[model samples]
Target: MRRSGPVRALLAASAAAAVSAGLVVAGGGAAQAAPAFRAPMPAHVVAPYYETYAGGSPAALAAQSHNTYLTLAFLQTPAAGSCTATWNGDATTPVSKSVYGKDIAALQARGGNAIPSFGGYAADTTGTDIADSCTDVSSIASVYEGLVTTYGVTRIDLDVEADSLSNTAGIDRRNKAVAQVESWAHRTHRNVQFSYTLPSTTTGLGATGVALLQNAVANHARVDVVNIMTFDYYDGASHEMATDTETAAAGLINQLAALYPSEKPSHLWSRVGVTDMPGIDDFGPAETFTTADAATVEHWAAAKGINTLSFWALQRDNGSCVGTAGAGACSGVAQSDWYFSHTFEAFTHSKWTWGKGRSPWSEPKPAPRQAERGSRM
Candidate 1:
């Protein structure tokens, strides 16, 4: 969903740390049926990268099995070496502006939540590079903790990639700061959950990602999920996007096995998540992750007990025109509104209670199609 900037080349070029090769957490014993891992209720079909452009969908999203729209940014200021946060990209509009109060309230009304995502692709130039800029880990911890406390969120995801991932020093600071936040949350009994969103290939995480995960495991950083952005493979792009996703996940699973030798295959899979670019990706027309691809990947991820499933954005899952190129607002495909959301809804229902029962969302479906509005990748 973010700018990769020659991702495959980077992963290939960076020396793979002598750590585990690949993985995503799995859960359960063989006797139990392969049930869907309902990511904490009102948390399935999680969608990040939600900027102001996505205006209004809290009601629709909550009703359609969507939960937790990861508000785009918790940007940090550069000069002070301290921190300040914004919900959108605008530096002037601090999150305290209450720009998202209404949306957050609406989602909460539906028993959903808004999780804050930090350090995205633009972390390098935007002055939000927490990893590199926040050398004072405590200050950054306060920043993240403030946002989480404000939002009353139980989970926080760090979309670490691009420049954010490459800096070794920043990675160290990030892991430590995040662990500190976890410590605070535990003390306050907030039961906060931490996860990482890293770039990946069919084989495994790049050197930076591997190092981050290794550090988390080694430091005992209570990481709840390791979600990989399984798209924009570029040179590594494959015809079968779903199969490519499976291959990529398999590699990660094996690596996780080595990291947590004591955990079973099911536990490792349960801790794993895969974020896909469900349609034409940013690279161009050549790389397209389709609806059918979403179905196949959903089935496999569900069968394997993959913890969570998501895509680059929600603004794009429409039948709007995207021409021949990819557009960020509309998934470049001919389909009904929220088609992608419905497809991904497959993963939201049915709890995988470790050999227990499975249940589906009996909520209301979308209304009759209207003159829907949209833009593109």
Candidate 2:
């Protein structure tokens, strides 16, 4: 669904404010202006998953100005000296020696944050299945504490999406898992951030899904964000296929906002949101990076008062666009292109400004072309 006219007007106004002070590139030759003050979204954090092999590389992490990288979880047995499985089925090793140190150091050196995640999509290859046994709390806590002390990471994301949420036992187990983690984070003197990645609301997963998540967030005081997995809705239904993914995302945000108020005396509304890995399939038959679609999603988020805006990934759609025909340089590099273009365009064309009184990263303004020598003389 397209953004309502009023919402579009708001976006336009925001863009204009951002541009006047040179928060974004106005054109190729325009001179850079002094920075302006703009309030940033309180929790505008991006959580890119850094593969273990991809660890120790600051180049990619530095380019994005990302706030956090939710490193893939470590699965290990409960035994004291048991080996741990990294996300990619790589050889098991101690958290201190291998992945944790390497990943955190690289990201931190680049001024980015890293958080260790516990559970992922894969089944329990790690002999100790925390999901199966709530009693493994101490072992889970031990790993979490060790990572924090070793890597100096303050955040921890728990990706708890499992195969079933239909039964009470399942939901209870999920709740306990969160409680255990929060308890450990408190004891460690580390301000840990907790979150869950669940399917979007459209799926027939029902209130059980919502209940389990809401309970987890409420009971576990330290939980900070709940990232809704809003993409991959390929259910063979026309409505599901044809629905404007952004609008659907907006509605979900609104629902969560209402459920968790910003002014609540206790928590930060644990900002409700949706994330998608933008791709040809995301656009369906249109097969393109729909600027209008992206705008609509942003507008919906702003209008509904959602606290954060995140995508499933950054690398996927950085600088590419697909059209009715197929994918190519229909525009530019998908993910990177959109990030730079939209980020600048939003400043030039909308109201949001950079948080640090400067653009996240600066590009040099083009030099003026030389005047025609003969004609001028």
What are the lDDT scores of the predictions, listed in order? 0.60, 0.41
Q: Over the stretch 82-176, how does candidate 2's per-residue lDDT look in tens digits?
A: 33323333444455434345434544544444556555444232323344333443444555555555555655555445443433453455466
Off by over 4 Å in 1: 3-45, 53-82, 125-127, 236-238, 354-377
| Model 2 lDDT at residue 77 | 39
- After TM-score superposition, what is the CA distance of residue 305 in candidate 2 from its true location, in Å? 5.0
Residues 1-377 of candidate 1 have per-residue lDDT tens digits of 35322211112211121012111111111111211111232333455445333343333333432443544444545432446545444565555415454445445544455666776666654546666766777777777776554545556778787777767777777788777877765444344566788888878787778888888876667667788888787774445678878988998888888888988888888778888776778766666788788888878877887766777765556656555345655677776766776776667664653432211211122233333221000
Best by lDDT: 1
Give the winner by TM-score: 1
**Over 4 Å off, model 2:** 1-42, 51-61, 64-85, 124-129, 133-135, 162-174, 203-205, 214-222, 237-270, 281-292, 299-307, 319-377
True-vs-predicted CA distance for residue 112, candidate 2, Å: 2.8
In order of appearance, the predictions have TM-scores of 0.77, 0.59
